[model samples]
Target: MTAPLAPPGLHTTSLDLGGRTALVTGAAGGIGRACALRLAGAGAKVRAVDRDAEGLAALADRARGLAGTVEPHVLDLTDLDAAELAAAGTDVLVNNAGLQLVRPVEEFPPDVFHTVLTVMVEAPFRLIRGALPHMYGQGWGRIVNVSSVHGLRASAFKSAYVTAKHGLEGLSKTVALEGAPHGVTSNCVAPAYVRTPLVEQQLTDQARAHGIPEERVLSEVLLTDSAVKRLIEPEEVAEAVAYLCAPQASFMTGTSLVLDGGWTAH
Candidate 1:
């Protein structure tokens, strides 16, 4: 007997990145980890970059059964030279490494702001620079920068994050324009309050900054603007990254694929 067809809206086509090499910074956990696994499942050799050595090892182990491979590359994005070198030969680049500090502009530490910009903006620029030669030579590449709702909208006590994301958004658009003729597509996946370690830590930080209890932080701050009233899963954001890397998204360049749960609608 023949099997029943998939229902409407079901995704039957798999994203195939076989033979491609993908580099995902901050791949030790959260959205970066999910994106690495998703690309590996699509048969792309994933270079998982993170300062967390043990976490990368664990990620590699978990990716063992996937269609492709996950190779751990322990490198801190703060090391600009090394970070750029690491992106060499990569066919797909996912600049997902980031750091966040919750504090008012007046109270925000200068060092932390520099660190955030280094990892989120400067490092990504170098990685893109290093990866461009190969991509342009081959006439094809994918660059997905994992931005955030803060990139488009500002929030109190998140000065550094907002600034860094806004810088990244501009960088993504510039890359898109420059890379278009070379068959490379550059874009940003902007998601709000993803259920990740970063957001978990932000709960406490937000509470402290907002003068609210920890439990109240979720409802009062985090989910207050979210129409969906829930945190987005890392896997959901990973699907967006995968789609951007897929051949089907060739024409979708220089745009923010926002998964903000209507946060930007207001």
Candidate 2:
């Protein structure tokens, strides 16, 4: 029998975002951390925003030696006013901060659902509002929303997360439409279960919620619809964000760049 050949290697970009100011929420870890570092690598001054002060500090340490600087801005996304202020003067905005509580709507706490919506949807709206004046004045900007496969598909016992992501999709599109004339582009990067701290915590929560063992959660709950039976890497998703911010993607707006490992193919 003939041996099978390897598939083509994935290619990355060397985008130059020099002299740009980028604000990335949830920049302390996971996809946010990767995005912060990647933007810095492309020569942008990055404002890394997150609630975890210590995590943000560690991220700054790791960001050393990149082509640009990373200024850690420690703040919780729940503070809507502060979130809007922090987004001011940004040439690129990545709304990546979010919270999740997986439970049936009937069983899920209403307060938790509200918090998720506030952080994932409302805060993004405020941030975009803050960033627009600067972008419009300069006649250029990029906004990338870190949505999820859940934004396009529904999964059980994840009412809060699903609702928030779907709402985010709408928010991104609205921003895209409004900002088009001002030389700003808005889009969403929807990824399936990227290996992140949030998702790691979900493994435990999902296990408890479903009464299943933690080990089985990855296969049964997370990757059930993914044709590629592996969690996505944060760097891979970050690369997509970078691509959206690059000059080549200026014409690409009001669209969802999905990195779902074929989860949505069905």
Most lDDT-accurate candidate? 1
Candidate 1: tens digits of C-alpha lDDT, residues 1-266:
11122234534236999899999999999999999999999999999999999999999999999999999999999999999999999999999999889998999999999999999999999999999999999999999999999999999999889999999999999999999999999999999888889988887788889998888988889878977777887888898999998778999999999999899998
Alpha-carbon shift of residue 238 in model 1 (angstroms): 0.4
TM-score of 1: 0.95
lDDT of 2 by residue, 155-262 (tens): 988998899999999999999999999999999999998888888789887898889988889888888898877888888899999999988999999999999989
Instruction: Tell me the alpha-carbon RMSD of every candidate.
Output: 5.4, 3.6
lDDT of 2: 0.91
- How much does candidate 2 score in TM-score? 0.95
